[model samples]
Target: MTTLPPDETSQAATPAIDEPLERLARFAFDWADTLCDPDHGCGPYHRAWSMIRLLTKNSALPAGGAFIADGLHRAASGGRCRVLLAGAADTGLVALVLNALRAQEIEPEIVLADRCATTIEQNRLFARHLGMRFELHRCDISALTCRPVDAVVMHSFLNFLPVPARQAMIDALSRALRPGGLLIAHQRLDVGRRKHDPQPIKENRALLESAARARGYPDPLARAIGAAGADFWSNTFAHAPTPEAEFLVLLANAGFNLISLSRPLAAATNSPLFIAGQSRETPQAAILAERMPPR
Candidate 1:
C-alpha cells in the first residue's frame, strides 16, 4: 500500500467543459445549443463528466487532460493486452482510449461493457463510424465473467452503485485482471457531502453558475449548466460521492496498490483519476493466476 500525501482538495467537479461540448457538437449538433436547459434545476447530472481528456489538445493532467496513455503503454508492454472499459456509456471515451493504445502500438483486445441495451446499440454505431473494433458486453459489470486483463478504465461509474454492489464490482474487477494489472478510474470524491433538494431553485442556479465560472466556462455555457442543475442532481447519479480515503480503503482491502490519484478536471466530485494495481499477495490474484490463460 503506497502512502500518498494528502490531496490538496477533495471537492468533486465534472469533467472539463470541452468534452461535453465536443461530443454534443459532433453527435447531437441540433441540441448542442440548448443542451443545458435553464428550466432544469441546472443539470447537475446532465453531461456532468469528470475525466482527463486523452487527446493531445487537452493532455495537461490538471487542465482536464488525461495522463493514462503513458502508464498504460508501459503496462501493455511485452505482448498484446486485454483492456476493459466498464460501464461504457458511449463510444466517445472509448475512441480516445483506442487512440492512446494505438499510439503505443499496443495491440489490445478491447471490451466495452455496459448494462444499458440502448447504449450498447448506440455504441455499436459509434464504434463502426469511428472504424474501431471492440467487443460489446451488455450486462452489469459486477456480473461479468471475463478473461484477466492488463488494465481497466472507468469514469464516474462506480459512485452510482450501492456500497455492496460497488464492492462486488471491485472484486469482479480484481478477478478480471492479472497480477500487477491496473484499474484506472475517474471518480467523484465528495458527493456524499452535497446538500440535496429543499434548497431553492435560485440558490442552486447561482451555485452551479459559480462552479462553471470558477472552472473558466464561458458565460453562456455556465448559465446552461446552471439551468440543468436541478435535473443533474435528481436524475444523474444513483449514489452519493465516496470520500477518497474510504474509496482508497476499499481498493486496498481488495488487494490493490494505490499508484496515483489526480484531479485533472473541475467538477463537484473532484473527479480524480485513480490508478490502482493488483498485488501478488491478494487472494484474488492467486485465483486469477490459475484461471488466466498462459502468457
Candidate 2:
C-alpha cells in the first residue's frame, strides 16, 4: 500500500443544522466513541454483548467490509484509485476496509464523510492505527458537495434523510462517481404492512427478550425492556418508514443501474445490501411513470 499525509479537513463550509439534530449527532458520536474506541476499556461491542452488538449492527461490519473490498477490486486501480467511504461511525468497519485494501495491495485516496465531529476524529484515529490516510468531510450527507471518485460506500446512513433530500443526495453521489464506478449501499426497507406501523413494538420486544437471554438477565429485566418498546422505537427512529419503491425510484432518478439487491432478512433485517453501478449507458428516465403512486 502507498502512503500519503492524512487530511482531516472538510472542503465545504459547515452547513447549518437544527439544534436537536446537532445534539443527537453529538450524543451518537459520544456513544460510538465510548463503546467502540480501542483506547477505552471494555467497549460493549468489543465485548460482544448481544444486546448492544445486535442493536448497533456490529456483527455486520465484516461482511460489509468484504462486500466493499470486492467492489474496490473490480474497480482495479491499484493504489491510485479514489474512493469515498460514507457513514462508517458505529464499528471497526473502517479498519476492516483498510486491512482488505492492504491485502489487495491498493492504497486508494479515501474520503470519509460524516456529520459528527467526534466520529470524524474516531475515523482519523482508526486510520492512524491502520497506517492509512483519508480526507474527512464533516457535514451531513444532504449538504455534501460532490467530487469525482472511483467508488462510494454508503451503509444504512441515507435513510435518516427525508425522501426528497434522500433523492437529492443520491443524485449528488451518482454525479460524484466516475463513469462505471461502483456504489455499495445498505438500507433497511420500509415495505409491507406490519403489526405496528412506525413503532415496531413486537420486534423490539423480541429483541429485548433475545438480548436478555444473551446477557443472562433475569425475567424482571427482560420484562422491563420488553415494556419499553414504544419508548425505544421513538427514541431510536421516530420517522415513518420509507416505502421500498421510493428508494428504488430515487436510485433510478439518480442515474444508477442497480446491479444487485440482497433479499431483506426476515423482518429482523434492518438493512439489506445493494450494489449499483454508475451506468456506462445513458440513464433511462426514472421509472416513476411505471409505478403506482405511493399511498
Candidate 3:
C-alpha cells in the first residue's frame, strides 16, 4: 500500500462534487429523449443515437458483458437467480446486464438498490417503460440486511466510499452471496506517471505546481508532485487501473475464488475494472483481516 502525504490546503480547495454523475445522467437522458423526439434535427439525434448504438452494440458484449453475463449464466443453469444491483442509479448498467441475460433466455430477479430518491424514481420509471420487474430499495447499502443472493454486481460504487467503508461494503456484498454464488465488481485503477509526446511530464507537473501555489500552499513543487502521485495511484491502482495482484488478494481475503479477470483488449480508453469471483464455503475471514496500506 502506497501512502501519499496529505495536502490540507489542496484537500480543502477541492469541493465535494457529484457534477460528473449528474452530467452523465443528464447526457444519457437528454440524448435518449432527443433521439426519440420526432421534431429534433436528424443530425443531432442521428449522431447521439449512433453513439448509444455503438455503446450497446452486441459485438462488444464479449468483453463488456462477460463479468455480469458469467454470473447470470451460472445462475441460469441453476433455474433461478436473484441478483442485487448495488447503487444502480439510472439503471444504465442494469439495462446492459438484463439485456445480456435476456439474450440468453434467463429471467433474473433483480433488486436495484440506491439511496437517491430521484435516482430511484428514474430507475422505476425506466423499468416501467421497459416492462421489467425489479425491487427498488431507496436506502444506504450499509443499512441493508444481508440475504442469500445468487449474484451481486457493483459498478463504480466502491471507489466513492472511504477505505474502511469500502472494505465493509465488500464484506457485506460477499456475505450476501450464497456459497458458490458470484460477485461482480467494477472499480477504477490509478495509473503511474508516464511520458507523453503531445503533453510532456514537465508541463503537466509545472501546471499542477502552479495550481497548488495559487491555492496558497507552501513548497508547491513538492506538494504538486505528491498530489499528482497520489491522484495517479488512487485512479490507477486503487480505483480505476486496479492491478491483478491487488484484485486477487482482495478476493482471497473476501473468501472468494477467482473465476475470471479481464481488462480492456482495445487501445487505452476510459473503462471500468471488471472482476468476477465466487463465494467459498470456507470463508477466508483471516485474509480479510490482513491490513492493506492506505490509498
- Output the number of the lDDT-best candidate: 1
Query: Per-residue lDDT tens digits of candidate 1, residues 242-292?
Result: 677777767765677776666442332222121112111110000011122
Which portions of model 2 show Cα errors greater than 4 Å? 1-63, 191-234, 264-295
lDDT of each: 0.51, 0.49, 0.46
lDDT of 2 at 234: 33
Q: Which pairs of residues collide in candidate 2?
A: none
* Top-TM-score candidate index: 1
Each model's total of backbone clashes: 24, 0, 12
TM-score of 1: 0.58
Q: Sort by TM-score, best first: what order? A: 1, 2, 3
TM-score of predicted model 3?
Answer: 0.52
Report how far residue 250 has shifted in candidate 1, in Å.
Answer: 1.6
Candidate 3 overall lDDT versus native: 0.46
If scored against the real structure, what TM-score would every candidate get? Answer: 0.58, 0.56, 0.52
Worst 10 residues of 3 by lDDT: 279-288
Q: Rank the candidates by lDDT, best first.
A: 1, 2, 3
